[model samples]
Target: MKNLLAKKDGELLVSRIYQSESTQFEVKSCLIGGEQVMVIAGPCAVESEELLKETAFKVRAAGAAMLRGGAFKPRTSPYSFQGLGEKGLKLLARVGEDMNMPVISEIMDSEDIGLLADYADILQVGARNMQNFALLRKLGQLNKPVVLKRGMSASIEEWLLAAEYILAGGNSQVILCERGVRSSEPWTRNTLDLSAVALVKELSHLPVMVDPSHATGVRSLVSPMARAAIAAGADALMVEVHPQPEKALSDGDQSLTPRGFSTMMRELEPVARALGRRLR
Candidate 1:
């Protein structure tokens, strides 16, 4: 009788067993879309008419290439704030039309695809849903671009496979996002995996971005990490900004004030220039 199994004691292996050739994929540059990097910035969620419009205008004026905000938030606690639902999506869509910038927001379920597709120019599949194969399959069927994040507890290979799910589904316009991952240390909300930023560019044909805001879960850390992400070869940056972080309805602690965001953009400009990339 053959012993069918040996004890494997470590991380759960969810990665597809294939080493992608470096040339097999290439990041589709947003520069081709009229910018060197695609800056997706907005509030954590769209709370109201005034707040949403205010943040949208400010970020656009500050040179963001794209806009983002969560209309359907996926919080840890059921009692915690969820989102504005389809109404929020409509607000984001209206902002896109009014401001002339592409809108990006999270899609929590497969069922919301049609409703959300009508609103968002780019659909964001958050870190929590990175490996939600069913959701990935649905997003892949859409025609819009996807901003896929690395799972909170997923490995590098697992992350890429998630991206592969979208690519394999016949949608090639995918963007990779490294938004940190859970670690034993609690100094920061999650350990920022800057190495994954480098590795993704090395391994795949997708444009990679980083979210320093969620990575640290603190306003102070956003700038430094954002600068580091650019130097580490990130194709774009996704930041959360609010006019008044202290009063924001969600994620205020991690939200950068408009003043802070302007400063971060200034510092990031030089790094982008050094990398032969332009800033809008």
Candidate 2:
């Protein structure tokens, strides 16, 4: 109990203890942790320049402020498609510039920090690497913003402590993302833990975002859970949008079509407005 309480105190993040406001920062023109519930949408991976450009354009039209696509993918299987690497980062940077939007992408190691920071506007520390203190500290020293996703098996205190690793390194522009938690139920990919969204609001001053696409791992559930996230007070959302889900290189089942994403954006507006926030 004592150790748990000490963890919750988040010694390294005391400056961000939840009061009545959240820490805000700007990525290009998008104000993260601000009034609007920012949305980041794009392919799960940089399959190709054409596919990436198409998805970026569509999502931007649907009201997304920032774009996202993985360059260094951390796959569970050894034989699975390991992302396009640095080449993918170049394409992501090019498309993000052409689309006139800020972009976010994952960082798997401290060595690749310089490479990813060169292209991505917001460097994302994926769920699997949540406890990677070494990488987290490297990210903290960067001037760029970082989106830290919650580890599937980690507790809330553990998640905050991971962010502390970055905060302790001196980067205050950290956004916590809930991508769901591992569960026994096989019906859904992972339980979306909406409670965490509300809880983080009270436990920390940092803004919280949700990745419904990964949380449910089903296209149909993405939009509904996205709405729930907004109602639950998510400051932003990271959704995967592939032009054609059926042909996606990765996470196709959970990716939304361009048209489907447009429809989902339309449906999310009222929910955000009801909470006195706008769906960016």
Candidate 3:
């Protein structure tokens, strides 16, 4: 793979100049950036304690290495569900602990860092907050790992530099996520940008994961893109898996039901094997 670093961009801390070797670190017993691709799956938002537990159990049983749920959602409309807030975080942590799985949740405000850090094993910097320097700096100060998602309109170079903010803050445990970028096409929610998966793998040593659920925003396409992501050199995948998606509170159309996620996992196994990697 070619390491395509722009002439003027190599000075950033996230650039490959500082670290040529891949970043492999243990997060809740799973080695990210390693040969074993990890699968992090769960509902888009934590609806209820009972529902969260059911979905968490299902995704874990289907081979998800980590549990993901949104406690504080950044919705386009104020009238929509904003998430369960601290209640959701509590449920995610409670269920994850009971199941012995790591939990991941998004952090919107810098003030919520301690609150989220107390529950979420990994603090996710959503696409909207990709360039939130204040929040990024706060995450940098913490020892926790942060999953920095690419902004909907941010360039790959800009995205890497955003990760640089966290790295420069003295926290090296940062994971990059490509959750699709804004595009004019109407069929898909956003372009998945599979090339970025390969590019980031070469441009930086940090592990890159793709969010097919948000990328395609369609249940039928999530599985297909997930397999393609692994083939394109993605280190892991973040999928939205819900129980009875039709009745879900958020992103029901794009969320995969438990059965669909199971079938997707079955399809992903061979593709991962083809690359000499196993989904953890």
Candidate 4:
């Protein structure tokens, strides 16, 4: 078998089929690839209009390039909050317009792609549907950018192939996200694979980001993991932040407070600079 990754001319090569090609795109005023480390910080779900507004303004003030939230959450349990649906998307659009920041939200059903694309600046395919080929193909047909999260149980090859589905369909504007994966250890919510961050950068040209909030499932661990992700060559970071975690309707345990997100941004500056990257 051939090596999946290698070094060429002092640069890492990821895969023969998926050769590394730098993909750069703009989100409003933020440049995704090249030298800028994009930070996308917001709540896990849009609980309320007021809360979404508060988190949006705070994260933007903290230098977040884009705001992220879930309009259609796919929960393990049916009884849990499933997001606010179109109402949440509307609120997110309003906030992004008012704040002059682009917004991203999860689109579960392929049927909702048009509606979501109309409101959200970017469409996110959550981990649960990373291999949903039909959805991936549909996203490929759209002009909007899609953020594809790595599945909890998917291997590196499998994850890249999933991205292939989107690319083959004619849309090359894809962003890969590493949000940790299932593991035997029960101490943390999920075992974050920092190695995958490095591997993805070597394997594909797609811009890869990390989700430390979901990866660690602990507020305190978020900052450290986020810092490590930047140092490890992640192109961006998607963090979950809420004004008040205790009052959040979903994923409150892993959500960071506004203050916590600000501090993390500050601490990441030196790390980003050392690596010759700028965190805006």
Off by over 4 Å in 4: 1-20
lDDT measured at residue 163 in model 2 versus the true structure, 0 to 100: 86
lDDT of candidate 1 over 121-186, digit per residue (tens): 788899889989999988778887888899999987778778777866878777788999999977
Over the stretch 1-280, how does candidate 2's per-residue lDDT look in tens digits?
A: 2333244444446234333467888888888886799999999999999999889999999999888999889999979888999999999999999999998999999999999989999999999999999999898898889999999899988898888889878888899999999999898999999999898777778989999999999999999999999999999999999988998889999999999999999999999888788977
lDDT tens digits, residues 177-270, model 3? Answer: 9999999999989899999989888788899989999999989999999999999999989999888888888999999998999999999999
Order of candidates by lDDT, top first? 3, 2, 4, 1
Winner by TM-score between candidate 3 and candidate 2: 3
Clashes of each: 2, 0, 0, 2
Give the Å shift of residue 154 in candidate 2: 0.4
Clashing pairs in 1: 25-205, 26-205
Query: Would you list the C-alpha lDDT of every candidate in the order shown?
Result: 0.80, 0.89, 0.91, 0.88
Across 1-280, the per-residue lDDT of candidate 4 in tens digits comes to 3554443543332243445558888877878888889999899998888998899889888889899889899999999999999999999999889988889999999999999999999899999999999999898888888899999999988788788778777887789999999999898899999999897776688899999999999999999999999998999999999998998888899999998999999999999999999987
In candidate 3, position 178 carries an lDDT of 96
TM-score of each: 0.88, 0.95, 0.96, 0.94
lDDT of predicted model 4: 0.88
Looking at model 3, the pairs that clash are none
Which is the winner by TM-score between candidate 1 and candidate 4?
4
Sorted on TM-score, highest at the top, how do the candidates line up? 3, 2, 4, 1
By TM-score, the best candidate is 3
Evaluation by lDDT, superior candidate among 1 and 2: 2
Candidate closer to the true structure by lDDT (higher is better), 2 or 3? 3
Q: Whole-model lDDT for model 1 versus the true structure? A: 0.80
